[model samples]
Target: MSVSSLALAQTLLNGALLGCLFGSIALGLSVKWGHLGVADFFHLSLTLLGAYLTYSLVTELLWDPFLTLAVTVPAFFVVGVGVQYLFHLIDAQPFTTLLITFALFIVTESVVSMIWSPDLLNLRPLLADGFTTSIRLPDPLPRLAVQPIDLVALVCAALMVGLATYALRSTRAGRAVQAMRQDAAIAETLGVRVLPLTLAVSGLAAATAAVAGMVVSLRMPLTPTLPLQWIGVVVVATMLGGLGRPLGALVAAVVLMMIQNAWSLWFPPQWAPAVTFGVLFLFLALQPLTRLARERITSGRTA
Candidate 1:
């Protein structure tokens, strides 16, 4: 299985592009988990729903795929806010939120399956007529083909991360979000508008999911169960990157995608998932040791 240099480069490029979309999908989950302490597993399902919606809009309505974002983002934002309100109404704990959202995930998956009929859907046909022109690399990198939608997804993912970072760092609402994450009761006592901030962040996170889903529709075929494959890797990436850290999530996802691509070069495609969960298990196994080492070092310094 000798691979050419050009082939390897192209593989890596595709992996990176896909990783960017993965980062986009994970961003909303990371934000909600980090800030709101709600492990909204259903975020992935929402993303799939967004993809299905994008497919219908593009193929049936003859709209540009990217144009669907204008509709999905705001609609999903409202959905996110409503979901958050449900959490609040129930006063759900972290574990409870997980169960509730997982239930929602199942329901969403079922609904999408019912509506979309478990068929594999994509925007490729709609994009075939001059919409998705591929770009060629120049000189030393000639023959490396870059799909337009792949590039678009990469750019959109980066932009979403940047926007989320800016919102978190530069705005009053962001500071409120940070404070609330640290301690909701304390933040509330300190005059931070925790409720409104929670709703806003949740909505923003859902909006990110919508963008991610729209990108996914442009880049790959859609199915109701698509989220199952993504949920594990994205969740691992989100956790390893730290909750609410959009940039960290993006970097982790890209690296993971690269590793998976490299692994696929030598191994079977079915074995690729081993790479994702293997990294996850390795990280989880190391966490205790890492924490203990830090604790011992702190005690030694105190001595």
Candidate 2:
């Protein structure tokens, strides 16, 4: 390949890896919003919480960033369960639930700002550093080197998504949860424990957020405001990916990231977010028509 072509290819690879992390973030939101029918506006808050907690622990106790997950994952899971219970008690209207969680997002962001400020905090042991230090890709791409840590993070994300998909497809609990999404009352009548199942799903969502946070920290600097960015991108991914499918989330993320990277490389940096939103708009415009055609085809098949 020519130099420019090689560079673009390398950039795309990096983008895909980053996209996997983004997809993982969306998985949690998809479960809460798509499957449970909960408006989990605060899903990104758990990610920010994990990021800041990891930062604090590493700074204070000198723990490894990977090791911090041992604490943050379970802690966030508990927090998620508590949040779900609170939502249940309020029996909130959809808008009210959305507003409450939006407010919670603001509160969490404010707290993060208070504790860590808006300053960018870079985690030590960045996988990039090691890649820059000792490794080089054989490709003729200028300044492109694959890092071991990057590979590790990408593999972990892929594995997590795979396991989540398998669980959703193969497990009894997974079937019950899927049934709940389709018809909550019917599922409850069939011996599904609604409350506990919801709690478990919520906890699982939080744990996913935690894992995403860890991967993100390894790859990029953490900022108090970063979670806000995640909320938007993840919401887009979830909606475009059909919400409950982990594999769909992964594909959506890769597509979005490729679009963003290609746009920014060939065009202006400021246009990247606009292009991402444009892709989302296109997807929204097409989805209903796609659904209608599918339904018509099914009707014809049955006829």
Candidate 3:
């Protein structure tokens, strides 16, 4: 069976929107692991909690969905800082950080399950007719469906990535973050308050996760185990783009997600996941050769 051009365009559009959501989801992990050297797997758990909280507020308290960010963002920022402080207390090594965060992820998941009962909750009821509202492309192009929530996720992703890129490039704290990444001892010697900077970054990372979570609830349902499903793609995007590179992660996620979505159009749905990991594997396989080529180029220049 042949697919229509319009169908393909619609698929691509959905992929792009979902890609932004996934990219935003991975940002917290990217920032924490990339800059601070803390893997912080609990970041996803915090997102799940945020999504559930948003659902509760929208359903129980009759608050607007977007307004939920006002609560989740600050709350999760504090949670992120507290978790970072615990890491500081332990002098968390790479392996230990991973293990500790994994444990914390489990604990947080348990808390959410107990509170929310592992149910699939969403803001659909609160959204009413707004959920189905779509933007139609003008004539000369096939009509493509776009949801308000999708635009919300895309905007949030762009803002988070842009703000992060700007902060890292234009702000003093960003330079200190870069310095710490290069050498914490040197940055500290240069009078950078390394500890406070890390706490602040951690808080920001958690805030992004909260924003991501609220965006997610606007689009999808929340379940206690949802993070498990997300962890793979998020990690792939994070590693593919490298840690601390939010913009890179977003680009990687969008590309990977689009490819995966395209694959589903022609191939079995079961094989769709292979498209994602296969791309990652291909990149990993090429990375060493790319590194070697760069080294040779540098050597030739020196010669």
The per-model lDDT (C-alpha) reads 0.88, 0.80, 0.88
| Global Cα lDDT for candidate 2 | 0.80
TM-score of each: 0.94, 0.90, 0.96
Residue 91, candidate 1: alpha-carbon lDDT: 88
- Alpha carbon deviation, residue 67, candidate 2 (Å): 1.3
Could you tell me which residue pairs clash in candidate 3? Answer: none
Residue-pair clashes per prediction, in order, are 0, 0, 0
What TM-score number comes out for model 2? 0.90
Residue pairs in clash, model 1: none
- Off-target runs (Cα >4 Å) in candidate 3 are 140-142
Question: In angstroms, how far off is 228's CA in candidate 2?
Answer: 2.7
Tell me how far the alpha carbon of residue 267 in candidate 1 is from the true structure, in angstroms, after superposition: 1.4
Worst 10 residues of 1 by lDDT: 122-131
Tens-digit per-residue lDDT, 250-291, candidate 1: 888988998899889878978998898899899999999999
How far residue 45's Cα lies from its native spot in candidate 2, in Å, is 1.4
